[model samples]
Every structure is written in C-alpha cells, then in structure tokens.
Target: MENTSTRSTSRPSATRVFVARLVGTGVFDPLGDAVGKVHDVVVLLAHRGQPRAVGLVIEVAGRRRVFLPLSRVTAINPGQVITTGLVNIRRFEQRAVETLVFSELLDRVVTMRDGSGQVSVRDVAIEKDRNRDWKVTRLFVQRASSGPLGLRRGETFIVRPDDVTGLAGSLGPQSAAALLATMEDLKPADLAGVLADLPLARQVEVAAELEDARLADVVEELSDDEAVALISALDAARAADVLDAMQPDDAADLVAELPTAKADVLLDLMQPDEAEDVRRLLTYDGYTAGGLMTTEPIILPPEATVATFLAQARKAETAPALAAVAFVCRPPLETPAGRFLGMVHLQRALRERPQQPLGSILDKDLDVVLPDDSIGTVTRLLATYNLTALPVQDEAGRLLGAVSVDDVLDHLMPDDWREADDAVTDEMIERSANA
Candidate 1:
C-alpha cells in the first residue's frame, strides 16, 4: 500500500480547520474497509503558534480508541471522515506515548514550588480564561501559618506558570505534544537533570526516547553511581556506547561500579585504551586523591618558555581541569628525575612577558600531594590555599595527575562523583569470577 504519512511544513488550510472542528461530531470511514466515530482531534501547533490538526482520535467498534494522523486522512465530508490506511491499535498502544497535556498530567505528582522557597506542588491550578480556554495557570501549595480568626488558616501558596522551575512553554494539550516531540532537542545535561528528579521508570522511559549521543551526555552528567545504575538498566550495546563516549577516567569509574559479568561484557566491547584507564582507576581507594584525579591533563616540560607554553596550550586539546592551569615539571613527576618546579595560571600566562623563561614566571612554591593522601587532607589543602586545583605527585615528585575543586567537592559530597565507581566494581567482579 502507498504510504499516507504526510510530512507537511505548511499551516493547515481552512478546509482542514473546518474538518478538525467536526472531528468529535462526525463518523469516520477507514478507506471504505472499516468505520469509526471521531472522539477528538489531536491538534499539533506549529512553531508560529498556529494550531494544526495533526491527528484524529477515533472510537472504533466495542469502544476501542484509535488515533489517525492527518497524513492518513484520505477525505473528509460533513457526514464522514475517511482514512486511507489501516491502523493496528495494539501497535499504536505499544508505541511510546509522548507530550502529555497538562490537563492529562493534572492530579499527577508534578515537581513545583512557591517562589524562592522549597519545592512543593500539592495541586495544579486549572483556570478557565475569558475565552473559555482551560490552562494550567499556577501550582497550588500548602504551607504552615496563622490565621486572623485566632485559628490557623492552613498556609496555602500559589506558583504562577511563569515561576515554573522546569522547562517553559504552554502546558496545554498541543503544547504538551510539542514538548514530547522536541524533547530530544534539549542538551543532554538539561534532559539528564530533569530526568534525574524523576522516578527510575520514568527516567528509563525518557532515556529510551533519546538518541545515543544525547543519552551519552545524560549518562556523563549523572553521579557515578547513578550512571552505572542507568547503564545497567539499558541493553549492553547501548550502555557500552554511552561509556565509550565518556572521558576515559569517567568511563572507567562507571564501569568499575557495575556487576562483574556485565562490566566485563561492556569492557570487551570498548576500545582497549579506554578500558585500561577505567581498569586502572578501579584499583584505587575511593577516598584517595588518585581516585578523584583525571588522567587527561596538559603536561609541560620545565625548559619550555612562557611563549612556547602559551602556543602549545592554545593548540593542545586538554580537558577543562588542565586548561585552567599550566603545570611545569622536570622529566617524570612519577620518577626520581621528575620534580614539581612551578605552575602558571592561564590568565598570567596570557598577560606576562612572553619571552620570559617559564621557570622564572612559574609559581615555584606550589602545593602538591602524594596519590595516597586522604580526602580530608586534600580538602584541607584546597580550603587553606583557596586553590582551584592541586597537582598530585608520586614520592619522586613526578606529576601523576591533578584534582580539581569539583573533584574535591565530589569527594566531600560523595553524591557528585559520576560513573567511575560502578565501572570499576563491574571489572573487579568479572576478573575475580573469571579467575
């Protein structure tokens, strides 16, 4: 059969509008093969704010509800609506539902709160406007307070639609549909944050709707434990792809947190170097500097001049942690020959004399640490010196890695660490079980 999925970019014509209006009142012919009665017209709004009839919700024999998009509509008359193709209700039901209208979401637990206060939403405010258009105008909340009658009137709060903490736009049926359709357009970080607040089932549902790259970003932003949990919920192939897209250190951490058999399966699917880095980090104690540091940073030779360092830095594809500070070290910071000479802040490197030897301009007296240092020691050093990051070195003073303020915060908070622990745990279990 010829495909009837219409892909139109233009607004619905006058005739289309008239037909849409008659949707609930008219009978529908399934291209002369079957018949049904229209129950509703699912309107999809264009970017320009024009409402277009995108689909028809019809009630079939025995009270079965079926939806038919405009593309499937072959004809429409005063008495009857004609569909050009057949639709399997079971298949339609199986397809993920997207863009739920505010009306439909009403009475459902939604995240909202009074202005500047804690988040709390007891009920959604449904207002009938002058035009009789029903809209979710505000969120109602209950608080504690005293009343004028010498009796306490339960404290109640209202949150205007404008004050919504989440994504904005209309919460009408059509708008809800549009939100669902364009959900993938949002950045993963944004989507992840929103999803993070949702229940696990809902998170999985929304995650399945996202593309691989976007899903990867969501996973990357999640706490290490959360990422591992989410990935474990996904199919092995999809989970592996997300891990592969993350930074090597992050990927390793997450992999370590997973169950051994699964982690091994995922590792076997990943590239060798990435799997190795994650495996290495898995060996470290969770509370140590080594556990918090990322291996991907910019390293500079002690002999390199400020000018050269600037040039190299400009060209180097370093992570954000490395980009903030230029570390100057002699030979191997991990070996006896290596020494932590000094460091150059990016701002200083840009403004200072270009011809000056890096050693002369470098902050010779630098705060450094051994890999085995406790989280408490690292946190204290960072707080005392007010440093953005501190270099971690071996006993010989070779730069093994550097930990950022974020890493320290993660160590302290524990909740902020993403994806690394699970990956390590998985690998360890796998190795031990195999042995």
Candidate 2:
C-alpha cells in the first residue's frame, strides 16, 4: 500500500548519439578539466551488420594516443565529452593495444597454423540456413599466399564465422575502426579481370562505388580496346560520367570510338572544353596520329624549373593525357618551322640539373609523325626506335597530339577473340531467360 502510493520506478530512455558530434570532441579529466580530443571511434559489427561504437580514441599530446572504453563515458553533448572513470594518461599510453584474435583478423595478414609461414586472407566463405544464423564456413587464402600452408593444413584451420571469438556478435567501436582501415592489395590487371568477370550490373556498381583516383588507376591499366569495350557497354549517361571522371585525353579517346550520335550525346554531357577536344580527335581517321594522340599534353616553357614542374604535377587536378614527355616550347608561340627546338623526356626532366636550361636537354631528333600516318607505319616507328611515344605534328610543324606505345600495340596485336565467343554464350543465356 505504501509503495502503491509512492512514485513509480521506471528507467528513462538513453540519449541518442550522432557520428558527426562524436568525431571531434574534447575529452576531460576526472576533475572535469579539459585534457585531450577524441580522434576516432572504433566500432565493431557482425558480418554484414550495422556498426556500433565501443571505444574512443583520444589524442593527448601531439603524438600520444590512448583508447577509452565507451562504458566510461559519463555524458556526451555537443559542447563536451565527459568520462566518469579516473585514468592516468601516461598509464593509458603504456598499456599495450589488445591483440585481435586470429579469426577476427580475417582478410588480414596472419601466421599459418604450422608456424612455418604467413599468408594474407582473401575472403571468408560463410554458410547460412533458414533456421540458423550465418556462420563462417571457411577462409579463402589468396592463391599466391597459400603455397607454404599445404592444402590439408589449410582445411583444418577454417573457422565458423559465428564461432569467431573476440570479433563476433559485436558491432562496436573496434570492429568499425578495423573495417575502415582494412584494404586489399590487388594488381591492376588482376583487379581488372575480376571486375570484368562480374555480372554487368555488378561491374557498373563496383565502378561507380570506387573513388575517382582508384578508378583512374584501374582505367590506366586496361588495354585501350578493353577500355573502349567497357565504356561502350555502359548506358550513355553512366558512360559519360565515367568519361568525365577520366583524364581529358582519355575521355576524348574513348568518345572517339563511339558511334557519332551516341558520341555526341556523351560529349554533350561532358565539360565544354573536354567535349571540344574530343570532337577534334573524332574528326581524324581512327588509325592516324591525330586520332591516336591525346591533346592534353604536358607543356612547359623552356624557362620552367624542375621544382616548378613538380609543383604543377602536385597541383594538377588530373593526370596529363600525354605526360610520358613534357614538351618545352619556345615563347611567342613560335612554330617549329620558325625556330625548331627539342623535346624533354619526363625522366630527363626529373633528373636533369636544376640550374641547366631545359633547351640544353631537348632531344631535337625526336621522331615526329604526321596526322595522316597509317597505323602500320606507326607500328614500324615504334619498333625501330623502341620508343614509348611519339609526337604528331601538322605540315606547318605545329604540335597536334602524341601517340603512346600501347596504342601502337593495340593497333597491331588485338586481344584474342576467343573471349568474345564466351560472351556470346552469356548473351544467349540472357535471351533464353527473357523468353
């Protein structure tokens, strides 16, 4: 009766927290005095599950850092981060960072069971059933790193994902932190093959998901023909987006291969100058120097310094289309016919004496091809000089573009047509499905 007449006992809902507010917060000492700032929060999550923070990363001095458990957080507000536990900063710094369990570090470098070697994991194969939770079925070791661990030994170490200790059933700070930092090192060619094998939809999704810089690197690795085919397969809008993300010259080259109507639609979607440059290339015969060359060449005045070149390189928003060599041009827009000078190979530009004038190092005998030169002729020039690239000029000796060795190779030996036949099988399957 006495209790019934009194106030009811109930717990209030906990306050919610947002990531933006948590990112940069001031940590305070037990006395409520400001001490440090939180640098990052470590979160852990279940496989393909939501992320949740469990620990705080605090930076004390310029270099000193420590981890604090979320359980110690007393209050979290826009203005400050308060903790209830009193801990010495020096002691926290001295504490060893916890070692993640072998299973928790899947897809990371880990020692083999034999203790004979190390291997990097590729992926974690998992199993799931309607009635049961998904569990890790096996660990997939990269083929290159599986040699030392015999097949039998590798099979024995595969752990169930659900059974993984230290990392499973948690979507806290540590897991989120680990996931963000995790990266796979893949060769460009290998990555390209993997992307190519994915379903068309998935391929586009993956391409769209990648950061621009990484996408640029992947594009640089693809053969010109492969790049053209990939771009052409995408819908006009998406293809244009990828092209716009690419170097101006690369964008132009791919656009040049498209059918006129489609090409125009894509170009209209691109930036004005880029569209104009690509249109200029489109006017040339596909096999000619003008067609093969990129207009976005790196050009510098003869007086520009190596330091200046490096600075320009750092500031450049995109890689130059034809940067294998940097041309040193004369002032007042003098044509080579007026007073011919030399070209500066990029390697020479980087290593040449800083004080030496660029004119002194010009390769005056640099081979030049006319815009109308045949692909066969270009191939010969490439083989005869072992040149990686050659400049293209008009009859008046005005620079128009430059052709790369890779382009010449594409014009010579094309990719085996067998793969195209396989692609036909896939098309047949899709048609059958539709029917």
Candidate 3:
C-alpha cells in the first residue's frame, strides 16, 4: 500500500520532523481520547532512493503493539498525534523492504562523503517529498571527539542522507532482532519471501534465530535450492531438529534435495518416529501419490463417534485440507491402517448426531488411488470428485496417507512460483485497486 505518513509538501511546508522526538508521544482518536503511545516509526528503506516513513508502531492497552499505517493518521503535532480512529488490531509486521528507524539506524556510525572523519548518527529528519511521500531527508550526526582524554563533546551538524556512507549497510544483531520481532506475525510463505530478500549472511542469521518449528514451516515454503542452502547453513543438530518438525512429505522433499551423504546424516540425526515417516516418503517417486501425501492425515476407527471426529478435526495443529475428511479403518488406526473402510467428510459428520458412529455415515462409493498413481491421475480424481483430500490405499485395502489438493498444486506450479513476476504484478494491481 502507498504510505502517506507525513504532511503534504505544499505551499507552506511543515517543519522538518525528527523521528526521535515522536517516540512516547500520546496518540489519540478523533474524539481526543488517548489510544496509545508511539513506540517507533517504520520506514521503507531503499538502497539508492530516499527512505519513506510508512507508519508508526503504537503500544496500546495490555502492552500490545499494532501498526498505524500513515494513511490512518490525521495530524502530527508536537507531543501528540491524532488518528482517524479506525485502526487494525493485528500486530505490526515489518515487510522485507522496510526497517524500524529507532531500532536500526540510531547510533549508527557512518563515513563522511568527503575525506573528513567518521560520525555517529544521533537522529534523522523526515519530510514530505514533492510527490507527497514522507521520506528521510537529513541526518543529525556527531563527529568523533579529538580533545584531551575525549572530554569535549564533538561538534554536531545536520547533513543530507547522501552525505555519508554505511547507513544502508547491515546493523548487526540489533537489525536481526528487530526484524525477527516484526516477522512474528507473518505466515510461513510470506516469511520465506522476507528471508529470500536478505543477503546470505543475514538470511542465516535470521534462520538461526527462529525456533525449530517456525524454521521448518518457513523452509518448506522455500525453493529447493534455497531450502538446501538454509539447512546447510545450520549446525547439524539444529538442522535435524528443524527437519523433524517439518511435515513428513515436505521434509522428505527437502531431504531429497540434499546430497546423499548429507541427507543420510540428517536423517540419522532425526527422531526415529519422525525419520521413519520421512524415509517411507523418500522411497516413493516424487510424482506419485505416496510422495505427495502427508502421512499425518486424521485416521480413526470405524466406531469413532461424530463428536470424537469433530474434536480431532478442531485441533489447532490440524491442516484444513486434512481435517476436511477423516478416514475409517479397522483395528490399526495409524497409517498403514488395517482394512480400509469408507471415508467420512466433515460436512457429513456435522449433520449427524454426536453419538452416531462414523461408519454409519461412510462415503463408500468414493474411489481411491494407489501409491503408484501419477500426479495427473491424482489431480483428475480430486477435480472429478471435488474433494479436498483423496485417499490412497494398497491392493490389500490397507490405508496409507491421503494426497491433499494443496500438495498437488505445489508440484504442478513452476519451481520458482514463489518468486514469480506474475505474483508481484498481481499484488501491485491489488494495492493500486485498494488505493
């Protein structure tokens, strides 16, 4: 979205506002009731262009922080701010192209454009551009002291952002820590995009900072090459832990991308239970039903009650596609479940009495695919039946995992689908339409 956070560059120009002064300022709604305090200013930083102030991070009641898009702000006066009162409650997330001014740029040391010595940044000034965009235009800096025992305070001056170097370079751990805080609200796919935009060193740093489970989710959304590179960058113990946290099918796919020896080493390091499932998946051809299916689909005995099924489906960890249908089998409820019976769609279960058995509402007529079935076959079966997930069974009628439509689409899309230009164009189109 286009951010108009600063006052318009009009006939009477507004004063050059130093972002440091805005922190801790009280933010109020249209009715003059206090809502929150400004904690930080978010800016869109560009390598060769002016950095635009996009929004303010405001700390509300309960100490929760939310992003206040510049478009929502009505006025920015000394010691106080006013908003349109309509605010999104979602937590603030820093996009890949953006940075937090206070957390990243303050106290940064930069070299002067001329042959003069280096200076440390004290604060930055932002103003509305000719195009009405709020941009960082000047820097407040202090030259290094050259007096006896460094007792004298260094001279300070206001200089253009272009008057110094090193401002755009990495800011070390502080940058990564702030970036991680902003990333907490991002989805795995979006987080992967953010990681992809970083330099290799920064990518590794951020990946290392993530918890194993979160790292696994993000890794699954990355391209094979990127996934391998990221995994390789981690220490063996942590890498195996992340792989263990990943879904079996996804873990298998990533493992297959690694060198044989490295893959073997990682698999050995994984928990036996998790490693077994991934190993089984690795044996299947990438295009087949066994390869694309997640081994953790919801499986229950034929006698499971509607209430029981509903509870299982409602778990926070249950994937929507996998939860849409539950498989009914004989004695062994786990995959390679014994004597596969019919399946029960969630819709069918919802209409039945809580005490009713799943078997009584079984969808027996639905056809199933085998482990060796082709991707095209799996796709056609799902489309033909309009199913979110399709069961895959063996000749002996034993149930294996089910192939989800999402997994099928993942394979069907191009290798670089995440970085596709078409997606970028579509997003731009959407933003323009919203604007």
Q: Where in model 1 is the C-alpha error above 4 Å? A: 1-189, 197-217, 303-321, 330-340, 353-357, 414-435
* Candidate no. 1 TM-score: 0.51
TM-score of 2: 0.50
Q: Ten residues in a row with the worst lDDT in model 2?
A: 171-180
User: What are the clash counts of all predictions, listed in order?
Assistant: 29, 13, 0
lDDT of 3 by residue, 89-126 (tens): 67666677777776566666777776466767777787
Model 3: pairs clashing at backbone N, Cα or C within 3 Å: none
RMSD of each: 22.0, 21.5, 11.6
lDDT per residue for candidate 1 within 65-137, as digits (tens), equals 5676656766666667677666546312312232222222322222333333322233343333454333444
CA deviation > 4 Å runs, candidate 2: 1-184, 219-238, 247-249, 257-259, 310-324, 331-340, 417-435
Q: Candidate 3: misplaced stretches above 4 Å?
A: 1-175, 423-435
lDDT: which candidate is best? Answer: 3
User: In model 3, where is the ten-residue run with the lowest total lDDT?
Assistant: 1-10
Q: After superposition, how far is residue 86 of candidate 2 from its true place, in Å?
A: 64
Cα TM-score per model: 0.51, 0.50, 0.64
Residue 376 accuracy (lDDT) in model 2: 67
